[model samples]
Target chain A: MSSDAELIGRSLRGDTSAFVEVIRRHETAIGNYLARRVGRQAAEDVLGDVWVAAYESRATYDRSYPEARPWLYGVALNRLRRHWRSEPAEQPAPDLTRLAHDWDPWPAVDARVDVQAPLRRALARLKPEEREVLGLVAWEDLTVAEAGRVLDIPAGTARRLLHQARKALREAPEVAALLQVPTT
Target chain B: MDEMDLMKKLSDVPSPSPEAYDRARAVLETAVAEPVDTVVRPKRWFSWPRAGVAAVGAAAVAATVVMGVTGGSAPTGTSTEAASPVVESPLVKLASEVKAAAAQPGDSSLVIATKTAPDNSRHVYYTLYTDKGQIFTGDSTTLASSVTRNDDQATPYNAKVMAAAREAANGDVEKARIAMITAANNALGVGLDPAAADKAWADTQAEVAETFRKLGKEVPAPRPRPTGKELENRINNHLWSNATYALVVGAANTEVRAGVLKLLATIKEVTVGETDLDGQRVLTITASPDILGGNASAVLTLNADNGLPIRDEVFPAKDSPQPSKHAVVSYESSRVSLADVAAGKI
Candidate 1:
C-alpha cells in the first residue's frame, strides 16, 4: 500500500484515484474527529467540504510525513470552524456537547464514575486550547505531538496544555469520583 | 479506568455511514473531473456553435446560451424588457408574494424526479438534498434495506445554481436573471458593459470563423456583435436553462422556486397561462419553438398556488422525425429526514 504521502504526491501528478485511496484510509478517523466536535449530522455535511478543500490544496501537502491523518485533521478543523462560526459565541463549540447528547456513562467498568456532571464541568472549565489537546489525545488516540500538529501548535505547548488539562481533571472537587479509580 | 480512558469511552461516535463517505467523495471527484479550475475566470464553452457553417453544421457551441428545440436567431417579435425589469408584469409581481410567504422548515429536502422516455417508459430518481448543499441520489421506486441509501454525488454546477437561486430570493428579477445565467456559465455573466460584451461576442465570432476555416468548410458571413434581438436571445436562453437547472436540483427550496418563478416571468417568450388538469388548477409555462433556437418547444407545468414544478417537457420541431431531444421530466419534492430516507422510509 502506498503511504498517504506517496498517494498525495501521486494525486498531485494527476492520478486522482491515488487520493481516493488516501481518503478511504483516513475517512473513518476524520469522521470521528468531526463527530466528536460537531455531532454526526453536521459532521456528514462538512466531511465533503473537507475532502474538496483537501483535494484542491493537495499541492501544499508536505509529503515528508508518511501519515496524512494529522494534515487531514488540520483541514477538517478549518472546515469545522467555518461551521462553528455560524453558531453564536456563547454556545461553546460542540466538542463536549456530542458527549452530552450521546454519552450515557459506562456503568459496567465502574458504575460509580457514571456521574457525568463533574466530568463535563471539569472538561468545560479547562481553557479551550488545553481541553482541545486533551480531547485530541484522549479521544482521538493521537500522540501529544500529533495533537499539536493538528492544532498547528508547538509540541512543547501541546505537552503543557495536556499537563494542565490533566491537572485540572484531577483537582476538580466534582471529579473526585473519576480520580478515585485506582490507576493500573 | 484512567481519566483519559474514561474520556475515550465517553466520546465514541459511530463511523460515518457509507452514504456520508460517498457524498464527500463525490465532491472531490467532481472537482477532479472538471478539466480546469475556473477560479481564475470562467472559460468560454470551448465548444461553440458551428451554426451557419457549411462544414460542422449546427453543432451549437455547447452554451448556457440557448439553441435548443428551435432553429435560427431571428427574434420572435417579443419586445425587450430583457434589459431591465421595469413595468412589472402581473406574473413577475407574484414573486414578492411568493418570497414573502414563510419558507417551509426542514433540515433535509427530498426530491423524486421522474424522466419519461419517448417510448413512454419512465426512470425515477430519488434525491435527498441537505441545507449544507449536498445531494444523495437513488433510483429505486420502493427500496428494500439493501438499496435504502442514495448514491452520493452533487455536481458543482447544481450547487452554484441553487446558491444563485437563494440569492435571487430578494433581489430584482433582472439582477437575479444575470446571477442565474452567470451561475450557469460564469463566462456569460462576466463583462456585462455593452462594449465589453460586444467585444467578447466579436471574439466569439472570430473563433467561430476560425473553427469553420480549420475544417476547410466555407466560412459563414461574420455575425455582427450580438446586440438587440441576438443578445436578448442569448440572455433569455441562458436564463431559461439555468432556471430549469435550479428547479430540478432544488425545487424543495422555497426561495429557489420563488426566484425561478419570478425570473421566468421576465422572459416574454415564456407564456404562462392557467389550465384545469383533472379539476386541479395548474399553470403551464411554454417556450414556443421560435425561442428555443429552433422548432423544439418547452413546457413546464406548475402548481397554481406555490409555483413548484410538476412536469417539464420539450418536444422537437413539429415536423422533425427525430424524437424529442430531451427526456420529459416531472418531480415531487418534500421535507424529510436523512435517516428516514436512508432507512427506506420513502
Candidate 2:
C-alpha cells in the first residue's frame, strides 16, 4: 500500500481518488479534534466542512511533507475557529469544558483523577488561539511542529504558545495539583 | 500531567454524529458536482421605457439639484416638513428597523418593498414571520404565494404556476418560491432571483426526461426514482442552477451551512452591518477571508422588514477594490400556513 505521502503526491498529480484515500485515513481523527472543541453535533458539520475545504484548496497543498495529516488538522482547526466566532458571543463556549462526564476507558484503569474541572478552568483562562494550540498538541498528540503546521503558524511559534499555555495551566491551583499526580 | 497525556484526551472526545458527515459529504459533493458561477457580472436589464422614465426622473432631480446649487427658490421637491421622517431615505429607515429586528427573536413580522433598477428586473415585496416554534411563514409581493415547512419539507401551494413549472420539468417556480422563502425566513430578509436557476434546472430536467423517454423501449426496465440522502444529495447538489447557489448561500440548511462554515474558516474577519434597499431595512453581513486570493468579499444582506434575504453582493475586497462584480438575487413565495392565510396575514 502506498504511504500517505505517496497518496498525496498522486493526488497533487491529479488523482482525486488518492485524496479521498487521504480523507478516509484522517477523517476520524479530524472529527475527534473538532468534537473536542465544539460538541459532537457541530463537530460533524465542521468535519465535513474541513474535508470539503481541504479538497477544494488541494492545489495549494505543499507536497514538501507528503503526509497530509498535519495539513488536514490545520484546515479543521481554522474551520473550528470560524464556527466559534460566527456564533453569538452568549452561546455556549467551546465544549473544552471537558468535565470527565461518564467516560470509561476499556481495561478499566481506575485513575480517580477529577482532572477535568481544573483542565476546564485552565482552558477557559487561556487565549482562544492558545487553547487551540495546546489542545492540538496535548489532546491530538500532535508535536509542536505538527501543531504549528495545523494552525498555519511557524513551528517555533507553536512551541512558544505551548510553553506559555503550560505555564498558565501550571499557575492555576486546580491544574497544578493535578499535574503533580503521575499518569499510570 | 505532561502535555502528551493531556493531548491524548482529545482522542476521547467523541466524533460528531455520523449523519453530519453524511450531510457534509453530501453538501460538498453537491458543491463540487455543481459548478457555482460566483462571478457577479453587472446586469443592465432595464426596459427602454423604464430607462426613459428614469431619465426623466433623473432630469427633474437634476434640475432641482442645479436650482439648489444656484440658490434658487428653495428647489422644487424640497419641502422641509416633507423631508422629515415620512420622507427619509428608505435605505436609512430600513437600517434602523434592521437594527431593531436583530435584537429580538421568536415570531416577528415586517414588510418591505425592494426595487432592482434597470427596471426590467422583477420587484418584490417580502413579508416574513418567525413563529415561537421557529416555523417561518414567508410570502412575497402576491398574497397567493408563500412557503413553509410541511411534513419536514418545504411545500408550495395555490401553486399552479409552481406545479406547471415542475411538470414542465422546470423547477423555476419552486426555486423562485424557495429563494423568496429563504429570504423571508431569515431575520434579515433578503431578496433572491431564481430566474436563471429556474431556467437551468428546467433545461436539465427536460434533458433528463427527454433522454429517458428516448431510451424507454430500448432499456429492459425504466430507471427508478432516486431515493435516500445519497441519491437526493447527488441530484439536488448536481443542479447547477444560479438560484441554487443563492439558495445554498442564503439559507441555513445542513449541507449549505457546512459549506459556508468551511468557507468562513479560511478568512480572518467579517464585516457585518445594517443597510437599506428600496425602503426596506437590511442587515448586511460581508466577509473578507484570506481565501479567494484576497480578491473580493462575499456579501450576504437581508431585509429586516420581513426577515428575508434581499441581496448577495460579491465585490472586490481590500485589494483591487471596486463595485464592478455584482449579481442580484430575488425570490417570491408560493404557499403560506392555513392560519396565516385565514387571517389574511402574509
Candidate 2 has a TM-score of 0.39
Per-residue CA lDDT of model 2 for B157-262, tens digit only, reads: 1122122212212223233332322221111111213343334334433433443344231222322323333222222121212222322222322222222222
lDDT of 1 by residue, A61-134 (tens): 66657999988998887666555444455755455434223332222112222336568777767777887788
Error of 2 at B119 (Å): 32
Residue range A41-102, candidate 2, lDDT tens digits? 67776665676667655534555575788888878765554454445656553433231221
Interface RMSD of 2: 13.5
lDDT of 1 by residue, B1-346 (tens): 5678757766766567889988777655544433222211112111111121111332333321344211122222222324646346545555566677776777666777777543233457666677777666545533223224332345555666677677667666566666666553433324265454445455555555664464445666754334566556666776676677677666777777777877777787888888977687878888875556554678888877776678877766776443235546777888776666666666
Indicate the TM-score of model 1. Answer: 0.48
The two-chain DockQ for each candidate, comma-separated, is 0.18, 0.15
